[model samples]
Target: MCGFWRRYFFLKTLRGLRVLAYSPVTRPTIVPFDDFVLQEMMYAYKHPDTIKTDDEWIRWIFRLRRRERRHALEFVEGWSGTRIAIAGTTPWLASCLVGIIWSAARGNIQTAFTVAGFILTSSTVILAVLAIISSVESSNRAVT
Candidate 1:
């Protein structure tokens, strides 16, 4: 209610004045959102579901009052699909790595061995990380 109603009811305002003891909060003038935030809002609008990420689960724990839960499990499901698609194209990366390693093999045996070891370790580590990402995304889909 406005100040007049507040005075009529002897609320937090002064005894007989148009003064408000508390001032209203000012609205923020600007909001900045990244791609992730926009994608998440779109996911909620398109395919609502429980966002079952670990961080989101923690948020649910500290919620003050029960509000609507917009289920957006498709968010993670689509992410898993994208990860699988990326993993499927990993052969391209593998071929490039192999070419580099092959070129590195023109030197002495010890040099070739060390270079080969490093390239294989690094490239395979990338692939391994992709696999782990795929697995985690898939699990998130299942949980959500």
Candidate 2:
């Protein structure tokens, strides 16, 4: 059972990557939707009995909305970093996000939360680091 869920989540992540690679325009939505679906799938696995409840389902839907917001911010961050000559944080962030989703798929809430927090915090740190690097470069360029 656990293995199945893990594989499903992994495949879902692959599909999201494939979609992003094939269609850049819908990436913002697709990435978040992928996260949301993975989360809900985990949630469902943990709480199978509540599947019949509308409220329970709605909560899962809200997770999608949350993902969408996060996705938009990430996309904007990526774009700005690219434009400002900042180092790209996408590879680091993507790996962390993948770890978080994998944790969730295993139906381990504690692990999932820890992984999610790590990913979010590290992503912020990487972005800040890149911004500082860009600022330093800009200052150097100005002085030269």
Candidate 3:
């Protein structure tokens, strides 16, 4: 519950700041996380232009990796809407499932059914919205 609220408010803050301005019509290219780390390390360690005799090697490597991650995240901001929606709803869904199970264990079939119906309805709505967003984004990209 705490995590959900934190994430929700964090996203809300970002939206308020308009920090998520760029919305690509397609998902950004995904570089595997480990691969990106390894590549960044190699570039930082072996690239003569960045090598130094000081103890700043760790700082340099972290700075370079952070910058790359920032760019990747920026490029992937278009998927944030769907991602945020799913993330925000996941905890509620899980809790509902738990509640339904508990109700069934107590032989409250009616309660279980009611919760199940709500879950099904909410899930359908969420999925439909995601589908519509995906189709619209794809069509927009095609038009451009």
lDDT of 2: 0.48
lDDT of 2 by residue, 21-103 (tens): 21334433444346676656556655688688758756744554543243221111122323333233454566567767877
lDDT of candidate 1 over 64-142, digit per residue (tens): 2234322221222223444445544555556555556766666455665555566666766776775566456456645
How far out, in Å, is residue 94 in model 2? Answer: 4.1
- The whole-model C-alpha lDDT of candidate 1 against the native structure comes to 0.45
Could you estimate the TM-score for every candidate? 0.29, 0.32, 0.33
Predictions in order: lDDT: 0.45, 0.48, 0.51
Q: By descending TM-score, how would the candidates be arranged? A: 3, 2, 1
- Please give the RMSD of candidate 3 to the true structure: 11.9
lDDT of 3 at 112: 77
Return the TM-score for candidate 2, rounded to 2 decimals.
0.32
> For model 2, what is the error of residue 21's alpha carbon versus the real structure, in angstroms, after optimal superposition?
46
| Best by the lDDT measure | 3
Question: RMSD, model 1, all Cα superposed?
Answer: 22.6
